[model samples]
Target: MSRLVVVSNRVSLPDEHGSPPPGGMAIALSAALQRRHGLWMGWSGKVKAGEDPSGPISRREARGISYALTDLSQTDLDDYYYGFANRVLWPVFHCRVDLAEYSEARMSGYQRVNRLFAKLLQPLISDDDVIWVHDYHLIPLAKELRNLGCGNKIGFFLHIPWPAADILFTVPHYDDLLRGLSCYDLVGFHTDDDLSNFAECLRRQGLPDPITNGVCQAYGRVFRCGVFPIGIDTAEFERLAEQAARSETLQEPSQRIPGCKVAIGVDRLDYSKGIEKRIVAFDRFLRSNDHRIGKTQLLQITPKSRTEIPAYLAMQKDVAERVGRVDGELGTIDWMPVHYINRSVGPSELAGLYRMARVGLVTPLRDGMNLVAKEYVAAQDPQNPGVLVLSRFAGAARELGGAILVNPYDPEAMARAIEEALDMQLDERIDRWRAMIGRLREYNVYRWCDDFLLGLDQR
Candidate 1:
């Protein structure tokens, strides 16, 4: 087997700073690197002047993983990550044209950072190593690698929604960006919608005309682009859920449930998550469908993220007000229609909460792949499983077809879906849950990594 070289804007692996091994994306890749020896390259999230390491830099080691991180100055961080990638490209990719800040300064920073990745990466490359780049922060990286004469199978995966061509055009220099992307051996997206956007971008840019029109294409330039929807480590998540049940963090909530059927909503505190809308729906559900208010409970655990960004702060305030309104209107001492928590709990504690929930309400307005849905499925009891009420717009909805899909924008519809999901026949619920769980367990993160590498090998 060939060696693997994993690169991303931020290394997901653990460091001396005491961050837990990231539960999903980072942990999955770390497992792959451990199973098959390789080099993981990314930023150390630090800045120091004039001390650049120019080799296969190794930053730390733990549990069969060699963690490597390079330093970036404030200028590099501002231009590449904060300015271009997040402010410019990220918003455009995610269909937030209204927020995209396109300027030469940001674009220049984008290219400079990508070039830096390539320069640092050049020393690490060997004849047999397959280069795998992750997320939108490094779309131009493969092109940079190619410029450095790296012909090894290089793969890049985008972890955000790929906007429609009409929307993607909102970016100033998309033509150059798409062309740079085409240099990879394989490009991966989380859903058909995303792959469709990328393919349309290819056609619009006048890439070679030997094209079959569709949501996905077998080749981009000399590379293949695809939809490899990532999945959770089912067994690991199940274990986490079980452990969480015993965790002290969950003890209060578990005791408070008082045997009512729990509806779980776990998401990051992001505007696109439709968190506020979900609160309104929960309130409506309590108001109109009074019969279940005492029998059913809603627990929304949204861990805070991007707290420094203005948009994020606004979202937090919005969520807080909506949550308070729901509780104030519907609470009767023993039952609160909405319970909003802004924090992160370890995996074991999370798993316990997941297992207790009868209806997993995962209604993100748009998401690359909502791992919480997958985690909920993985945590359900095989004998008496739970229902997943997911959003039709979420990328995971494409793969988890058995979930009771709802239009997130419609509060009434989502509320009704919640009712239906709660009242679902046990045998049918078990059947759907079993099928979803089987799919999840089979296409776990290890398999996702393996499939991308296999495709890269073909290059």
Candidate 2:
């Protein structure tokens, strides 16, 4: 078997006691790495004040897999990570063209960092290793590696939405980014729509289309692009939910909001998440029916993210204020309409909450694949499953057909959908849950990992 080399923007390392990372993707990738006796390489999530960004790499090992990490200087973090990756790539990919702040320095920094990564990683690559690069932050890594005379079969998977040609054209040197992707042997997206959008971008630029059996010719290079919808560890999450449902931790939270059917929303505090709009819809739901005010509760669990970015900082404040405004108006002395939590919650507790809720609200404005939607489906009680009110714009909407899909931009429609979820019959809920869970069980995170790697290997 060939060794697998996984590279992402940040590496998820195990704890001091040698416990694996928390996320399903982390667990699945680590298992694959262990199976191949492979290497996982990326930024260490550390920054030295004035050190060279191309400094020595840090090496560690656990569970038969080698972990390689490198520290970046503060300037590298600011420009490459905070500047181009977040400010330019994130918003544009999410279809928020107005918010994309582009600059020559940021673009140069992004390229410089990719080159630095290639330089540090070039020596470590064995001839037989299959390289897998991840996310928007490292789009140019394959190109950089090829420039360094590495001939490994490299693949890239984008963990975010790929917008239309018009949206992508707003970015400077967009063609250059496309050429960077051409360097990879294979490119993967979350949904067919995203893949089509990528193909459209290529078509508009007069490059060969990937729509013809997923193969494309661009920049004098041949590559394959395909849809690989990511999934969670469904069985493991289901077990966690089952255990958590029986615990006292679930009981305490239920007692606080007596006689109210719970509707839950979990997201990182990002503008693309539509946290504000979701709150508005919840508020609209409350106002549209006076009798339902004390009868229902919306539990919004949003942890802060990307605080360094100006847009994210502003969104954090906006979401908080919107939550407070809704609570103040609709919340009575006995019951608050919206329970807004600004910090992170443990996975076990989250699973318990998902099980407890009557409705799972996952209404992101734009997303790669909202795993919370899947997690909610997996964590549900099979006998009496909760209805998932999902966003049509989310990539998960393609797979989770049983969800009550609504446009995130339309609060009225979302409010109506939430009402429908709350009022859905037990038989119908079970049917919907069954439709989603069956797909999830068969095509899980491990399956996704194998599929992507298999594609790369075939190429």
- How many clashing pairs in candidate 1? 4
What is each predicted model's overall lDDT from 0 to 1?
Answer: 0.80, 0.92
Clashes of each: 4, 0
Per-residue alpha-carbon lDDT of candidate 1 for residues 272-355, written as tens digits (9 for 90 to 100): 788888888877777778788777778899999867567778889989998887778677787777777889866777788888
Task: Flag regions of model 1 displaced more than 4 Å.
Answer: 15-22, 49-58, 208-220, 243-252, 257-259
For model 2, state the Cα shift of residue 109 in Å: 0.5
Write model 2 residue lDDT over 97-200, tens digit each, in one string.
99999999999999999998999999999998999999999999999999999999999999999999999999999998999999999999999999989999
Q: Look at candidate 2 and give me any clashing residue pairs.
A: none
RMSD of 1: 3.1
Candidate number achieving the greatest TM-score relative to the actual structure: 2
Instruction: Give me the displacement of residue 23 in model 1, in angstroms.
Output: 1.9
